[model samples]
Target: MTNILIADDDIHVLNLIDIHLTEQGYKVFKAYNGIEALEILNKELCSLAVVDVMMPFMDGYTLTKEIRNLFNIPVILLTAKNQIEDKERGFHAGTDDYLVKPFEPKELSFRIKALLRRYDNNPDEYIVRIGNTIINKKSYEVKVGKRTILLPLKEFELLYFLMSKPMQVFSRDHLIDQIWGLDYEGDERTVDVHIKRLRERFSKLTDHFQIKTVRGVGYSLEVNRE
Candidate 1:
């Protein structure tokens, strides 16, 4: 069954969409805030998400960005903000579609169907982003806003592994095993060199994320969300 998530602080709007999607045979997961929506997503394999722009804890744009980095599901921004800049921001945040409030349920259904069909045939991207920085696992390319960058294979792999689990600490040994493989003869200092290069490359370029050393532990990617 197709699963859809509807996150809105307004109860009436939330229930209304739930009823419409349920009637259309979609298993609906409803959330009143961005945090709840993400919690549900972590537990359920939702096909798509309908997110409102304003909410407690996290806003729709940040939520969409998170979904883009962590999950492959499509996102539709649902909000009352209909300005041109607002739509542009939504797209830049990685939303697949945008439906303003005061929308027809049928229109939403149609959009949902279109996105699901599109994603089903879409190729694997394995893309992860923090703020303005994006790293593509498939291409080994790092992009910050409009500029595209190619990192050394090891550095790219290291940054990708760290960012893939934001804020999660990994010791050098675990990182070596994960990034360099268990058979690698290189010592853990090699990890430090690659990490140093990655840091130098992005230090002045972007502030979207940071690789922080965990004192006695190792390093972790800390995403600075807006």
Candidate 2:
């Protein structure tokens, strides 16, 4: 059974989400604040987390960052702030999805299912090697030479997809569909954000392989021959 954590300052909101998620056959953990959420996460293995933005002690953005650093679970932020900037901030903080407050419970369930399905569907167990970088899809591990670095779920997926098909140009739309899913309502710029983070994360490792932009087309992974 999959365990899900729901954290919100509002008791009504927490209860609502808990009831719905539990009814959907998920084991639910409820927390009223980000601090409590962290405590639950420390003790329990949650498959996914639904976090509210404005919480006591720790905000959702900070909690999401902590979760990303410590856990590999997917996160969906729930907040009343629907501004593009707010959504971008949530994503930048390492959330896989964002849902505005007063959203339909059914929609929330749908997003949860989609995210879980995507996470569980590993392309293959085969290890991919490019230059000094080694990508192990099975273990969700990336090693640059002897050093191992962690990446957020979406970023890792993007890297795996690009590396899986080196030198193959992928359009932004294609990547967004493949990675974020066709039902993704977020801005297409999300792809650019993940790509930028990937470049920055691996910049110090090696230069033999690079992710290149094809101008108006999109991006591709280029492996240089030694």
Provide the global lDDT of candidate 2 against the true structure.
0.85
Each prediction's Cα RMSD?
A: 5.5, 16.6
Please give the clash total of every predicted structure, in order: 0, 0
Candidate 1 regions exceeding 4 Å error are 1-6, 10-31, 35-48, 53-73, 77-94, 97-117
Worst 10 residues of 1 by lDDT: 122-131
Q: Residue 31 of candidate 2: its Cα lDDT?
A: 93
What tens-digit string does per-residue lDDT give for candidate 1 at 98-216?
A: 99889999999999999998877765437765667878898888889899998878788898887667767889999999988999998989878888888898989988788888888
Residue 17's lDDT in candidate 2: 86
Q: Where does candidate 2 clash, by residue pair? A: none
Candidate 1 achieves a global lDDT of 0.86
Candidate 1 local Cα displacement, residue 30, angstroms: 7.3
Q: What does candidate 1 score on TM?
A: 0.62
Tens digit of lDDT per residue, candidate 2, span 6-75?
A: 9999999988888998899999999988888877875666889999999999999998987665456789
